[model samples]
Target chain A: MDEFELIKKITPSSLSHREVEIGIGDDAAVYESKAGYEEIVCVDTMVDGVHFLSSHSSPGDIGYKALAVNISDIAAMGGYPKFYLVSLAIPSGWNESAIETMYEEMNKLAKLYKMDLIGGDTVSTNGPLVITVTVIGEIEKGKVCLRSHAQPGDVVFVTGELGSSSAGLALLLEKISTKDEGLAQYLIERHKRPKPQIEAGLICSHYERVALNDISDGLANELNEIAVASRVSIDIYQNMIPKHAELHKLHTEWEKFVLFGGEDFELVGTISSQDWERFAQECADHQVSVTQIGQVSQESDIKVFLLSGQNRVPLEKKGYQHFK
Target chain B: MDEFELIKKITPSSLSHREVEIGIGDDAAVYESKAGYEEIVCVDTMVDGVHFLSSHSSPGDIGYKALAVNISDIAAMGGYPKFYLVSLAIPSGWNESAIETMYEEMNKLAKLYKMDLIGGDTVSTNGPLVITVTVIGEIEKGKVCLRSHAQPGDVVFVTGELGSSSAGLALLLEKISTKDEGLAQYLIERHKRPKPQIEAGLICSHYERVALNDISDGLANELNEIAVASRVSIDIYQNMIPKHAELHKLHTEWEKFVLFGGEDFELVGTISSQDWERFAQECADHQVSVTQIGQVSQESDIKVFLLSGQNRVPLEKKGYQHFK
Candidate 1:
């Protein structure tokens, strides 16, 4: 199918409310905020090679992931995403069904998060697919979160198991543990569909967490960012780091994958020590794992130590490097 | 200079603003709104081949156009943009100073408009250069402008000349027009730096114009949209279209460049006929040319007539095809 056919098929049944003065199929989309909350504006670019592979990722996966990543960004800021405008550049002859699938998954997620798909520009180019989705979310007055408030003595926590995306990628690339039908499908899903920790972020924000950030660049690099931004140090207990047990069955270097693997898209946020117990209960209610991996300190460097083992290593910028 | 050097040079002296909880070099730039207005959000994408070309546009031009385009989206809805988040995908090993130059132009425009550069994502990509800018604006309730509000008798007006961009492109591609260096420069500048009519949009909204839109696509196409949305028709005078004298001197063939050529980035909005004089003077005070080119009609088909030639032609759906 052609692009238009695909767009028509996948265009959501509900794309606008009275608040959306104008929707898609124009130079831009125009939306209004009836709630009167300040707009939480964000733009994310998903390019071929750097963010996703056209060969490996399906069209629905691309569409879904594009919106999913932007939603995750909104989640990181402790805001409820309200609307999205997508700017897409895809190769000519892009399949209509594939495009529909992409929008279907994207629509599913948007409905799940209560954010509206408002406006954006769409064009075709003679190059790799480039999808940029900008989402606007809202937070109660004076309730928006940031990443620079991780005070000394705050506890650093992450939601969900790390190293899954890295493990999934390794399983696909190396073929050491995958090619088996069920396992391959599982790994592929892990890499393509990122679970946004919106509920946990909202709960944390309500409790006035010290700081928060999403870990798209793996643990070490994210911690480095929080430490640098907040001017604090961390001593992460390696044994306390959560890892998917099934991943260890596929890869030998579990620690390396957990530390430097990319595309995890989990929340690696900080909270005050007093709020840790309540956060734990909230995560429990949400059925997502919450692991306290480290503590904030007034010291200098970020360090990693194994509680069970004596080995300790100072991390030097581990995780995804876009240019390198 | 390289990318790193470029970033260092254009970090913006003395910080962006106090509302930015975190600026560049973090997961995301955090913003806090203090103006107490509701949030309005929009995003735009410009690709090298689809939106521009490096041989035709430099980094600074691309950057300025990038911001201007997104701001225009906000203007379409009668909103004042406040903050922008930019994302770029440039070929690795490209000019470093070019990125810095782009940022310099962006900050200059941002400061001029009282908007802050809050956050953005940058990465090296194998594909052609892609720049996506997302803007957040604030709007008063019931004042958000839209294209669906046009009435049958509303006067259709446009700001600035129509075919300068197409005329400019023609000169560039033909190369012979370079003989007139000053004229060539004027056309090229118009093409590269098409200004967004933000202030005019605000004033029009305050006066409650019947309808509004920006002329990124050709005038014929934009009018068709307003017509379809309002379930009415527009009668435009062929002679009333404001085209540059230089463009008329340079081109002999109509070829629909004036009628269908796009990227003018000017305001193509409408108001009641009674308000035409007041609207024109209001636009004059802002130093923007506002000329009535058409009138809304109850008829369903748009009719473009040359009263002098005693000729009438139905406007065809000829303009930039999004999927093509």
Candidate 2:
């Protein structure tokens, strides 16, 4: 099929949001802004071999993950994802059905958030397939969560378990083995389809002075960013970092994955001690796991620290860094 | 350099616009929405070896054109360019300095429009380099031009000359030889840096019920889109279509380039006959060439027609379809 036909086949017949004045099949998408909301914009690109292995990932999984990662950014900002545009550079070997399946998977996730697929571009590429998704979201004028908002007395918390995605990736790449089929499948799911913590982010936005960062580049790198941006020191208890219960069964060094492996898509942030009780309760009511992992301190000499029993060691900012 | 350091190096110290509350270094960029404006969004991706040859075009040219194409989409909607995000997938062979030059070139263009560079992703890819730009612009509420707003009695108009970009590309590829060095250089610049018709678009927006479309996909294809969308027939006088004065001096079928060539990045649309005189006067004052190339007709049987003397031929939609 040609580009226009493929677009027509993939575009959803109806848009979910009234804010979208013009969807696909336009020179540009038009969105009428609301009176009291601020817009959040972010773009993320995933390449065939760099971001995902096409051999291991289904087309649906690839598409879902591409859009999910952008949504996670919106969640990190304590915003609601309302619209998205996807630009795909398809390799010649791929079939039309694969492209359609990708959009279908993306639409499935977008429907859950009431987000509209506004506009995008599709072109043939001679190299690996590249998918870039740009998401436009909104939050109340003064409610955006930023990394620089962390305060000295705030308690750092993380939503959901970390390192499972890395374990899942390791298993998929055959770098590690797990005897339990159920655990292996669960970890693989975690790697391929990460659920963005939008509900937990919304709960954080209700409270004042919450600084947020999505853990895409591992816990160490993300925490260091928060500390450096806020100009505060952070200390994390080794025992308090949340891990999947079945992750210990794997043969890999699970601690390394938790500390430095990336693509968790979980929100890590700091909140005032006074708001932690109410925030934790709200998250619990929504069935979202919330754990207090660290604390922000006034000391600026050490940007990040790991506290293991008695010894306190400075944490190195190590994660996925491109062009290293 | 790592991703973080590279981002820090490229990010502007001060944003050009106050609406951009949070720029790079965050999960997402935040923008304050204005009360009387509607947002216009568009995305375009350029892949190495497909869109342009690395040997022929500089990194600066590729970067500028990548963002320029997106800005053209915004211009087609008669919107004022505001902010943009760029996602780049760099191949292993590319150096940090080349990437910096790319951003610097893009920033120069952004400065011309007072547009701010917000947030985007940079990742290492094993395949060809890819650049995807998403532009966010705004227009007065209810003033956005569209392809579907053409009327039966409207006069068809196009801004600037056509066919120069295609001629330039041919010269770059050595498909056609040109002895005139000045004309060759001019055509090459036209192909590498086709300025978007933002001023012409803003002028069109000031008038009521103007149908606008960008000529990225050739005159025939773009006019056919307007005809189909507006459910009207269009006729273009072959002799009236504007061309560069020096374009005919080259040994090539220049008419084919004007009609079927893509990436000219000029504006083509329909305007009411009653408003054409004032619109033409305004465009002349701004030094934007507005030519009346054709007219819209009430007949819906034929979508688009090209008239030459007494003969009329149906214009085929034959401009740049991927995966043919």
DockQ computed for model 2 against the true two-chain complex using alpha carbons: 0.90
Task: For candidate 2, give the docking quality class from DockQ.
Answer: high
| Tens digit per residue, CA lDDT, model 2, A14-96 | 88887788889889999898888999999999999888989999999999999999999999999999999999999999999
How well is each residue in B132-243 modelled by candidate 2, as lDDT tens digits? 9999999999999999999888999999999989888888888788788988999999999999899999998998899999999899999999988898999899999999
Q: What is the fnat of model 2 with respect to the true interface contacts?
A: 0.89
Clashing pairs in 2: none
Task: Give the Cα error of residue B21 in candidate 2, in Å.
Answer: 0.9
Per residue, candidate 1 scores C-alpha lDDT tens digits across B231-306 of: 7777788889988765666766643667887878887877888887887888888887788888887665544333
CA lDDT scores, all candidates in order: 0.73, 0.91
Over the stretch A203-274, how does candidate 1's per-residue lDDT look in tens digits? Answer: 766877547777787788777777777777777888788887666667567777788887778888788898
